[model samples]
Target: MDTAREFLENITAADQGDRVSRLRFAPHKPHAEPSFYEYSVLRGVRVESVRCGSTLYCSFTVPARLIDRNGKLSAGAIASLVDEIGAAAIHKCGKPMDVSVDMSIAYISDAKMNDELEITSRCLGQRGSYHSTGVLIRNRTTGEIVAQGRHSLFSLPATASKL
Candidate 1:
C-alpha cells in the first residue's frame, strides 16, 4: 500500500506532458478547489477514482455530516454529488466545455452517515450537440442502489488554454 501511494504520488508529480494531460482531465486542484458539495463537512465526500474515454466515470463517497434531520444523506447533497461527478467527467475531457444542460436523478435508496458510497458513470451514446452519460450511486456497505440518473453535458470550443 505504501508503494501504491508512492506510485500515485509520483504519477501526479511527474512532469511528463501526456501524463499531465491525463491528470488535467481532472480539476486543476481537486482537493483545493472542491465543488459546492464540499462546502460542509457534514458528509464525507471524496473523489475516489476517474476514468476518461468516450465517456467518463468518477466516484464520490459521502461521509455523514450532511444528513437530513431524518439521519440520512440529504437529497441536495446527493444532487451535488452528481454535479461534481459530471463536472469531473468534463474536466477529464481535457478541454473546455459547457456545463451540464440537462440531468435527472432518481433516488433508489437511502444512505446513512459513515456509509461509503460509489458513484459510477458510463457513456450512453450521444447526439450531435449533446453528449449523454448515465450515473449510478451505490452504497458500498450494503450494495444498495442508492440513486441513478442521466446527465447531458454540452461541449463548446475551448475558451482558454487548459494549462
Candidate 2:
C-alpha cells in the first residue's frame, strides 16, 4: 500500500508541466472514449501509481453494470482496462510516442464484477524501434490473477492525433 501511495504521489508531483496531468481522473474516465478500450461500469476508474521510468499502476472498481449474468467482469472490459493502462505507461516512458504499429493483448482470467481490480504495468525493455512491456491485473481482495498480457509497441517520433 505504501508503494502504491508513493507511486501516485510521484506521478502527481511530476505532472507539473501537464505531462501526466491529462491522465488524471475525469468524469468520463471510465467511459471508453472513441480511441481506447470502452467498458460499461457502475463505478469508475483511477490511477493508482505511475513512475517516470519503470512502473505504472492503475485500478478500477468494476460496477454491477459491467458484469455479465455470471457476475464477473467481462473479458472485453478487462482487456480495455489493460490497454488503457499499458498505453498510459508507454506514454510516460519519455516523450509521447505514436502507436506506430499493431498492438495486442492476451487475457489470462476473468475478473469478478464489482471487484476492485488493481493493475500493475512494468517497462520490460526497449530496443531500437521495439518497446516491450507487461501488465498484470489482479483482484485486490482475492489476490487472484484476473488478467495478464504483454504488449509489443513500436514507438514513432510522430504522435497520432487523438480520435
Candidate 3:
C-alpha cells in the first residue's frame, strides 16, 4: 500500500543519515565529572520514608532541564523516575538487582518546571524470579495524579545452574 511505502521511506538509509548528521555529540569535559544525565535526574530527590523495605516515598521538583519545548515535564523523564523508584522498592526488600522485563505507564496529568511531585512505589508481589512493583507520581501542590506505572523484573539466581 502507498501508506506503508510512505512510512518506510522515512527510515531509509538517506533519511537515517540525515537524522544522524543533525545530531550534536558533545562529550563532558572531564573524566572525573559525574554523568550529566544521572546528576540531573538524581539531584533534588529526597527520600521521605520507607516501610517494610518494600515501600518507598520520595519527593522531587521538576527541573528546567527536564522540561520539554511545550513547557511541561517530559514524559521520558517521568518514565525514568518510575523505573528508578519502582525498582528501588524491590531492591530495598533484599532482592538482588534484576533485569526489568516489562513496564506499563499511564500518564494522567502534566507537570511544569519547579512543580513538586510525590513519588511512591510499592511491591505488588513476586513469584519465582519475577517481581512486580507499582509507582504513582502525584503533584504535591495540587494533589493531582500525574502518572502511574507498573514494573516487572526477572531476578536470576546468583550462581549458574548445572544445565
Top-scoring candidate (lDDT): 3
TM-score of each: 0.62, 0.62, 0.74
Cα-based lDDT for every prediction = 0.65, 0.65, 0.83
Q: What is the C-alpha lDDT profile of model 3 across 70-136, one tens digit per residue? A: 9998999988888878888888344445778999999999999999999999999999878999999
Candidate number of the best TM-score? 3
lDDT digits (tens) for residues 70-93 of candidate 2:
888877666656555666566744
lDDT of model 1 at position 139: 86
**Could you tell me the lDDT of residue 131 within candidate 2?**
72
Clashes of 2: 0
Task: Using lDDT as the measure, name the better of candidate 2 and candidate 3.
Answer: 3
**Local accuracy of candidate 1 as per-residue lDDT tens digits, 1-163:** 3443354457644465655455322344544554333445323445555555644444445554467989888888777677656555545444554568888999989988777777776667656556777778898878899988888887664365486
CA RMSD of all predictions: 12.6, 13.4, 9.4
Weakest 10 consecutive residues of candidate 2 by summed lDDT: 34-43
Best of the two (1, 3) by lDDT: 3
